[model samples]
Target: MDTHEWQKSSYCQEGEACLHVAAVTTAETVHLTESADPAHSILSTTPAAFGALLRVLRDDDRG
Candidate 1:
């Protein structure tokens, strides 16, 4: 797959080695990948699933 137009979030801080995300409307899925390796490693999941996971993570981080 071509990854020329993917836009990563500016919030991806250094040293956390977090995942980067891109919107793929054709598939209705969000693409995820390591910020350190944009071309080599990628993952895809539904927006609903990703949002749920993000909510759970955010809740856990509050404590």
Candidate 2:
């Protein structure tokens, strides 16, 4: 597996283990995982798809 510079979510509380995200250098895929159990679960998606997901989530928050 390729090593990535994972970044924790800013929305996470201080000292709380929460969502982390990283971009794959070899491809257009982005990787998402939880800081508390990174080895147990991970999600991979393309940047475009991830962007669409975020847009939908934002829209939902407004509705």
Candidate 3:
């Protein structure tokens, strides 16, 4: 709800379009959205699932 403090991805280049994410501790969920479209939609996932996603993405970039 009101506690969503969205943060831009560190890998994002200087621009209006990029990934933004937030963690809602009360719900134990992670939230994701696009900076350029924050109002249009949002994606929510559990912390464990979000961690798995980051690991996979990191591994893909390393390969």
Candidate 4:
């Protein structure tokens, strides 16, 4: 998928800094970056790895 197609997350408000996530069209990959500094941040990982990261974040937040 074109990196340009990656839109900002709904949770991100126009006046606030946040992150964005997008799915890669050619593979089982996802891309992520900071909305405020797209050029300075990039993360590419498989769906499973991304899911695992989410779980870890959620678990960490609960603790």
Candidate 5:
């Protein structure tokens, strides 16, 4: 697999790591990993699934 350019959220404070996300060039999936332990494991999902997750989180935040 090709190396991906992972990006952390701007909301992350300095020295305080959070989830990092990257797009897979070979597939229509997004890769996710914790910044503090990137070598351990990664979560892969479709863009639609990721969007749904984000939407749910955002809706929950407003309630």
Candidate 6:
């Protein structure tokens, strides 16, 4: 497994339930994981897919 410099989401609070992201540039993958999961089940996807997901989420927030 590739190690990454994970970044906590700005929306995360002071608790275990949190969102984290890491961009693996070398592999062209965007990694996502929740801080609350002890098993650390990672979700890796292409940059384009990640961007699309973010865009959809942003639009949904406004909807």
The clash count for each model shown is 0, 0, 0, 0, 0, 0
- What residue pairs are clashing in model 6? none
RMSD of 6: 1.6
Of candidate 2, the 10-residue stretch with the lowest lDDT total is 33-42
lDDT per residue for candidate 4 within 1-63, as digits (tens), equals 244567777678777477778887678888888857746577889999989998998899899
* TM-score attained by model 3: 0.86
Q: Which parts of model 4 have CA positions greater than 4 angstroms off?
A: 1-7, 10-16, 38-41
Q: Which digits, one per residue and each the tens of the lDDT, describe model 5 over residues 1-63?
A: 237888886667877467778987679989888777746478999999999998998899899
lDDT of 3 by residue, 8-60 (tens): 89999998888988998999999998878757488899999999999999999
Q: List the candidate numbers ranked by lDDT, top first.
A: 6, 3, 2, 5, 4, 1
Worst 10 residues of 6 by lDDT: 1-10
Please identify model 2 stretches exceeding 4 Å from their true place. Answer: 38-40
What's the lDDT for residue 46 in model 6? Answer: 99
Using TM-score, give the best candidate's number.
6
- lDDT per residue (tens digit) for residues 7-37 in model 1: 6666677674666678877888988777666
Cα error of candidate 5 at position 14, Å: 3.1
lDDT of 6 by residue, 1-63 (tens): 246999999989898899899998989999999989989889989999999999999999999
Q: What is the C-alpha lDDT of each candidate?
A: 0.75, 0.81, 0.87, 0.77, 0.81, 0.91
User: TM-score per candidate, in order?
Assistant: 0.70, 0.77, 0.86, 0.68, 0.78, 0.90
Candidate 3: Cα lDDT at 19: 90
Off by over 4 Å in 6: none
Q: Which candidate, 2 or 3, has the higher TM-score?
A: 3
As for TM-score, the candidate ahead, 3 or 5, is: 3
User: Candidate 3 regions off by >4 Å?
Assistant: 1-3
lDDT of 2 by residue, 30-56 (tens): 898887774647899999988898899
Q: Which residue pairs show collisions in model 3?
A: none
